[model samples]
Target: MIIADNETAIDYLYYETVAKTVVKLIRQKSKEPLTIGLHGDWGAGKSSTLLMIESAFKGQTDTLCVRFNGWLFEGYDDAKSVLIETIVAALLKERSGIAKVADKAWDVLKAVNWMKAARTAGSLAFTMATGIPGPDLIQGIGSIASKVISDPKAYLTGDVFNKVMDGAAEHFKEAAPSETTPQRMHAFREDFEELLERAKVDRLIVLIDDLDRCLPQTAIATLEAIRLFLFVPNAAFVIAADEGMIEYAVRNHFPDLPAATGPTSYARNYLEKLIQVPFRMPSLGASETLVYLTLLLYLASGVSDSSVEFKSLLEVARKALQRPWLGTGFDRDKIKARLGSIPSDLDAALQLAAEITPILTEGAHGNPRQIKRFVNTMALRVEIASERGFQDDIKQSVLAKLMLAERFAPELFNAIARDASADGSKTISILERKVTSKGGKDADDDPMADWPNIEWVKRWAAITPPLNGIDLRPYVFVSRDRRTSAGIGVAGGPVEAMIERLATSTLGITQVTKAEAAALTPEDANRVFQGLVTKIDQTEDLGKRPPAAEGLARLCGDRPELREPLVAFLGRLPVSKIGGWVVSGWGVAVEGPQAQEFAELVGEWATQTSNKPLSVVASLQLNPKSKRK
Candidate 1:
């Protein structure tokens, strides 16, 4: 699917067109050194993008591009040291073309044994190394290396070049400052101009990319250096950037930029002086993106079944594209009108299919881990159904499987089980004692403490049309200590209530089955209670229960008899299974039926609800345990 074209080298993809635009712009402006800054997120193709650009212009234009790591030069102590090294290296590579012209120039400077005040040794080497007329670079390089070895250091650092230039300033009848580094600079600049002039015999362009990858301060300074100080008129600068990222960096470094300097607008105005008109990348339209994703899904999956189709697949893309970037919004009606026509039988399956698209596609939402998980999950079920030959039922099974997995996430069942532990028993009892006086408004302690556990609890809550679980928080009883000579009663009773809470919560954690109490693995049962205790402190909404369930389940481990008693105790009344758990038609607590009496109550609380039976189901699940069904 990746067809890289312009600066589109294999390692560096895309931006072929942009790179061409950049090259053409700089070539017409000047035939000297050009600086280009490529911008994007750290790995958003900035460095590699320019490398491809560099590759394209290599032979035709006397061009050079380097991906300098800002961090690499951090040890140099200051920006100047790094800048000098980098630019010198760049110039040397540029001037030291096929022939080695800088050879003689370097030999003259080195023989003088000069201390570098301005001219860089590397730049001098390039000028002296590249312009020779010989076919081989090394032949000329060796010729120069032989002459300059004795005083190589002086070629860049010394007083010789400046002394000669200054000595000639008046003789040439020039009036520029003769304090002489600039005169020496004029010497090198003239040398470079001549070298490039001869090498290309036409034009040259230098493109520098990935300045955006630099740390905030470094990027600003690097950009400032080239733009303001080293503004080579002949070398056109082609810089790419996200305007916001650069401005934010400036604001971070100088608070005054934001506070006093009209920081919000300053950087934008600053960039105006430098940035040549940008070649903007166009955004993909929703309908176009939809078609792109559809084709990608069909290609990746190989087969699209009735269980997964294009329309619903788009919605799945919605969930996968949850990140703010990429603009993954769904115009439901428009999408339906467009894709809604794709073979009616495939609608449900295609939507299911689309759900897996973002999982497969690479973009903001396309984290490989998320992609693998979605495929593993949905593909497993799809394969199973295909083998069984239940072609028609595949869509339902896939949805059921997804919903089943949802039940297990920290968000739902797991979270409820962890929070509904005994550690908060004393706290709840204390709240009760304090709240009884006004009967004052109940102080909301940790919301986690009283949240209902059990799959039934969740099922009831999600029920549409005023089911038994509709906001049934009030009737939920917090078992308190019975009054005694010790004032509010025996603290021992609270622990017993905690036990009852565990037994009830356990029914959800591990489904109760018939078994004998004696044969039950006592330790397994005990750890279930213990595990709940351990998890309460660390529990968040996506709560994790300790390794207590399996151990507790083993209490009856292969012993059916022992589990039977507890199972019967749990089975006092049947709780209708809503989705995963069985619940009685009562409001949010115990399992029971109260259709006639609760009718008015359901109607008064929620008049529009058509399904009254389910309303009472929620109410009962939240109620304390009624007799076993």
Candidate 2:
């Protein structure tokens, strides 16, 4: 059920080299207490690493596997009594030499168990199931008598008083040793050694699993107890943990106490060294990720092993990922159709898929959990596509429509911004208005035409759309200027333009590329723009203005019906012999100008410029209730 484990006769997917190294780390330890540490980013495979290594050392004569599951025990082992219980319990579970004297150990364990109950009960009365005490001063005595009535292990052969007193003294001493501080000492080892001596053994191997999942100090104390107390003459311990998480947890939990006391860092390191055969784990390779991903897709789609359908999905994934918007092995269509069918409430599923793919493929920058979320969202979109028959009938609830549009526009705008800023290039100007989904009106700014660089503006206008279109139908491309020798301002201030005059340029572009178009690279796109520059500069004359600069006299080359409102038209400049808008007006008289007509037209123009933008406007007539100065 928990796939966190690697190889345990389950559906164990193989990862490379991690398991073997961990085994080697465990197998090669010296007399010092060994603590093998396995670590990984959460869900990146630490648990699996632990289980694989655990399985590897299962029955080896020198190997003892103890899985210290965090959930089973609740208290911090530093509590004098808790540590004793943990060590004794862990040692018993193992096939240690101490196990041979199981009867004696069991008797000792039962006595220690009573320590908790007797401490809870009042001095004279030992609490029982009936909450009754004996007539005289019987603590554990009367209780033991009642419970051990027939069993010899519980029965007393000698003076039950003397035997009980000796056993009581030994039990307290073993639980809280006198030699070292109660919390820091290793008397549990002394007890274990005594038991092992009775059983006749030398070395013991124990596994501590899921220790990393506990509070760091508790986990550390358990390890410390295992290291110093519950051991034979030669003892080995292999602990399972997320090594980094464990270190962080331990450091955060204990702070200076563990480090300043002795070599806490060194002790931690020492423990780590014991895990000599620790199976190190790395992320699955791309091929392996794909294999698992395919398997996962097949399962999520509920399409059982029908080779025909599986193959069809694979084909869809392959083809869909080739689009510029969707990276390879990442088809948005496949994601929506075959993953989680995205719960319908998440209307931004398509856009989320587009954004997530980069993260998913980013070098184990993502894990299986993230992978699942992505698949789920994609699957949702697929369900929509299926229900709608890939047509328009799939009712996009208002929230969903708004979600799709808002999510799409800003991301697209950001993508454009990033593209413009990429490779240390500053984007001085962007001609399009970034249209997010809140309004019908779009951007009122387009400064590319007025920039001083005429030829650069020429090529930009030629290649880019005339104006920002809301249909999302335009093909975006990046064209690099490939010309090694072109004029300075040909393609917007050429490299080394101050002293240079000409630049050789090249341009190539194919518009109408689908959403799934081949990638548009900066170099290639720049080159295409450069070609357009070459064409425009080759034909246009910068030497002498064409009689009346055509662009100045009219709206522009394509749409010449409207006039440029930015230009000021004046009747006369008395000082100069010019028949154009004048900077100074002396003796500049037009006798038939209409005042009321001019006032209304001027008011309309002013109002419209502020409220509704026109691409081009001719002349202003008048603002009513106004007169010529």
Model 1 CA deviation exceeding 4 Å by range:
1-15, 30-48, 76-100, 103-192, 201-204, 228-234, 252-264, 279-353, 356-629
lDDT of 1 by residue, 1-22 (tens): 1121123253211244556666
In model 2, which runs have C-alpha deviations exceeding 4 angstroms?
1-13, 24-33, 56-64, 75-100, 107-170, 173-187, 193-205, 229-234, 257-280, 303-358, 363-366, 372-629
What C-alpha lDDT does candidate 1 achieve relative to the native structure?
0.37
Indicate the TM-score of model 1. Answer: 0.38
lDDT score of residue 386 within candidate 1 = 65
Q: Residue 404 of model 1: what lDDT?
A: 31
lDDT of 2: 0.37
